[model samples]
Target: MGRVLLAAVAFAGVAGTGNGLMGQDVPLAADFPEVYRVGGFDAPEWAEFAVPPDVRFDAAGRLYAMEGFLGSGSVVVIDTDGTLVRAVGRPGEGPGEINRPTGFAVWRDGRLAIADMGHRAYQIFGPDGEFERFVRAGSVSDPLGGAGSMGSKLRPDPAGLSLIAQGPPSGVGALTDLFGELLGAEAPGEERVDDRGLERLDLRGEAVSREPILEGWRPSTAGAEPPELSLDDLTEPAGMLTMMMSGQRWFEPGFLWDVLPDGGIAYSDSTAYEIKVTDGAGRAIRRLSRDLHPEPVTRRIREEVRERRLRDLEEGSDLGAGFRAGSGGNEIPAGIREATTEAMRTQIEDREFHDVIPVLTALRATWDGAVWVERVGEEPWVEFGPIDVMRADGEYVGTFAPGATRMPDAFGPDGLVAFVELDELDIPSVVVRRLPVKVR
Candidate 1:
């Protein structure tokens, strides 16, 4: 379940149903008859952190968690038994220290690489947790100079090369407008373009090749504002109402696209439950599909899910007081207090939910050359089990049970690396369990 990296790349076309990839429509109860259950590792009560966003495992099965935020961040290294071994890195501009770690990866040579967006560099660490060297990720001044944004996912390849999933550089106008937005200035009628794709970068910080994958939505806060309304007259009230609009207004849900080990790309269109895989030449060789029905998002279902989500947020973690209670603990003035409550109520009553949920939510290409299509479970929260598996030759191999394992953040020689958030405290813990040898 880690960022599933598939093996080998082939560009041979296949006929529709005759291709044998047309998956069978089977009930979940009957599909997963035998389950491959595995136990999870829980963090010790003594170890705690403000936030842990990323989890990864090196060749020796050692688990690492990127804990804390921008300035207060540190990498917590753990043993196989979930015991806190030690912490690495901190807020600093020095060699090993990192201001903000956005993404991380384990190189083929057993080197742990962490991308620090604050410093615009990737700090390389040896297996023993020692700082090796640093590589410039990219430059903000030069949009297309190197790897691009801080959000790029780093993947390891042969010959000291890495593949990064990032968008192309912004135009001069877009950069100008973006800077204006950061400075709280209005730059109306300016166009902003975000070209989504993949880039292959050499060890010397050079983008050797680029592959166009899909077009995605830019952040709403990126210079341009949403369409104006009567409420636009008084921005505060209008702004609260407008912000509550769930989902994207301009762009569709993005596809779960990733690059295969041998340089092929495998992705699923957001609108349908079909996987379009291509080889190094970028030719469509096969389309993997399943017998799935997009579940209807009825009014009742929508309301129920919304209620559950809100309850989880209120009870789960330490969200801002503004979100938990409308009054903001009486620290706000009466005028702003009334406006906030009214805006929230209006958003709940006026918001519209989609008619149907997408059949598949994510697509991952595993190390064994199998594609795991994550289906939208009947329950609202992210579900673990019943993942659909497809073979290398575009053939459905039935669903596999995830058991106690959460969605994997990374994979290693031992097994999948998953993170489980404890209740109430919302403490993060890492678990590495070996998958059953036989796929039931």
Candidate 2:
């Protein structure tokens, strides 16, 4: 599977400043103490292993890490004390093999659900790591519309009886049509607005309910109309083509959400520092808010964003390699590639941005029913920033500083949090930490 990295905008920070619903200011914690770490250069047992991007914890507190990213397409099982339990699956299309493991979850009954992109299906395994069955993609009806597959991504609900299936982008067809037209294909049909929703699927990959659990959400976008072009413009297509193409604007308020342990949902739909919690049946239960000031998108910030995008284009660092491989080994004409690059550059230069940066950038729900909302940082190119911890019932926990105190990649039982890290030499590792009692 291919991954696209976006150029993040740099910003300044005002750490530990937020007024919760209780009207009291809560400051950010300086750091989180590490309990233990695995798979680093210093660890001889795991020195050769690469830390996977997807991590989870079962009811038994055993950490499950997918090795699909850099290792064999298997799932690694590790004990809480950093002991290697075993590995399940391998690279292949056989009954017990996984081609490309994208996302996975542990069920309450000890079964493992793995979403395999290469196989285009969900692979199920027994608690003892025994392969059981495969649920092909597109077997279930999409809550948004038509026959929709899970698209190689899913999260186990709090009850572990169903999975939250993430569908494709709402305007993906429009984007497809745009690309088709560029390639001299048929024009796209009318734009669609009903395809923005998430469905609840059972362990068998069947829809639990025909209606979607979440819907009617869309990303914000700002760009000039695409200019007209013809086949004549691509006579010399070749060279590297770099561009920023998406339906979302830079630093804009996008969808931030997570599945709560109680089968509820926590999400932020606007730019404000407010979060809404809905019941398992999709009814609004409560709203959590904090008085955190939004950062203004100044002229300097806009110019900086534009320059960063243009710099990526000039360096051909983001999309050139992906575009080449996506062409199926066929080289795009030099003239067409150059013309497309120029057009993309113009669009990036003329791109408009939100007046102010969104207060929250990411959201995660823990097994204890607490929602961790990551606040935007002040530094440039910072991915994980300070996190605001709060209960699902609107109780304010507090905030933790970025650096070593940011939110964990996966929250486990008994106050355990997992962080996937990389050394200076690019070797991957998984760091386990125990959260403070008050925070956890």
Candidate 3:
């Protein structure tokens, strides 16, 4: 009775209905539902690449799209009449080789969690394909560390005494974000009832930090007692609800916006230029920013600074020990000092989005709501401006075109949206984005 992957298709059609009061448990869904998209995915040729990382929708609705990474990766089964039936994994890591996979988690009991991210790990494939169990995950790159780094380190500022009075700011931390799309059955009696605990986790043991949030998109209804809010009531436009965690990382440091409505959000905030806004009581209300980027990249330095001046008076001036003078983090070394100002204060006080931003690595989604913004360009080629937006105010609402590969994790049941097409990387295309809002 608990497996309903996605019957949520909403965007601008429900247009009106916010008064609340019917036993008021609040499941009419839309605490902060924003809706926006139309990146449906299109590939007619170009040698074919597909490049999907995550997307889901099984339960008879069928719309799965996984395609590991780079050519022939596979996991693209789409049908509702859309056809393209089989394309499961094969790259080499064992059991069918899918070492690069990155997104898809649909388990209420239906089971389907694939987030491989180049073998960090998470493998379960069955709706018919068989071959389950893999888990692993961790180190989504510097989980949290600064100075020496092993994770959770920082304290190194008081050296010159200009601020050498240290007592509180010890190594700057608090952020522990692991966005696990789902790891195993958490309730209904768990020990390994299997629902996804995948035999009770341990291959990595971070399994997205606790895993709960979707009981009706929980934020504050379960117990209610948290609505102080500040930062502009939490993003105004109406506030509360966000997820912008790496719409893709060419822009880096921005993505994962979920004003905590639990529509399942991940706006990626890597370090920070910040824009949080979590409400359904998840707290953290508003934090847009005085300079969240209107120019010169805000979200904390959008990564793309190349300033050269290596006057090789003659190849290290006749090498000897070669100290070619002129040191600036040694030429474009992924540099951006001040260690991202407290990683933007743990992404607005301990929420910490990640991988910084610039995603849309060539879009994918098709259970029915459509979201394939692979290159809705305007100023992108080296980096900056992959341009993306798939606003799921409820499900398939509105807005999709900014180069979005919208698949932070799960989606697939009724609104179906599972994409992967570039001559079909393994083959997956469920496209059902028929929205205007009918979130029922």
In order, the Cα lDDT scores of the candidates are: 0.52, 0.64, 0.31
Off by over 4 Å in 2: 1-19, 22-24, 28-31, 42-52, 69-71, 139-153, 171-196, 205-211, 219-244, 312-347, 379-384, 402-404
User: Model 1 over residues 309-388: C-alpha lDDT tens digits?
Assistant: 45644453323444344331445556665565555545445445545676776666555456667766655345654577
lDDT of 2 by residue, 1-440 (tens): 11111112121222223355443546756455777777877766533455445778887888888865335678888887888888888778898798766678886456788877666567789999999887764323222222223344567776655677655553344433344455455432212222345566665543133335666344444352333333343333311111113344566676677788778877776678877777776566667778776788888888887888799888875445535433335676665556767767866875667778888888888878888898887743466777778877777877676753656788877778898887898677888887766766
Ranking by lDDT: 2, 1, 3
- 141-235, model 3: which lDDT tens digit per residue? 43221111111010111111010010111111111111111222112221111111001122224332222221111111222122333444333
Q: Which is the leading candidate under TM-score?
A: 2
Model 1 spans with C-alpha error above 4 angstroms:
1-49, 68-72, 77-87, 126-128, 137-148, 166-177, 180-196, 201-203, 206-252, 280-283, 299-355, 379-385, 401-405, 414-416
Which of candidates 1 and 3 is the stronger one according to TM-score?
1
lDDT minimum window of 10 residues, candidate 1: 31-40
Order by TM-score, highest first: 2, 1, 3
Off by over 4 Å in 3: 1-19, 22-62, 65-74, 85-88, 94-96, 99-114, 117-283, 286-436
Better model by lDDT: candidate 1 vs candidate 3: 1
The alpha-carbon deviation from the true structure for residue 113 of candidate 1, after best TM-score superposition, in angstroms, is: 2.7
Clashing pairs in 1: 4-365
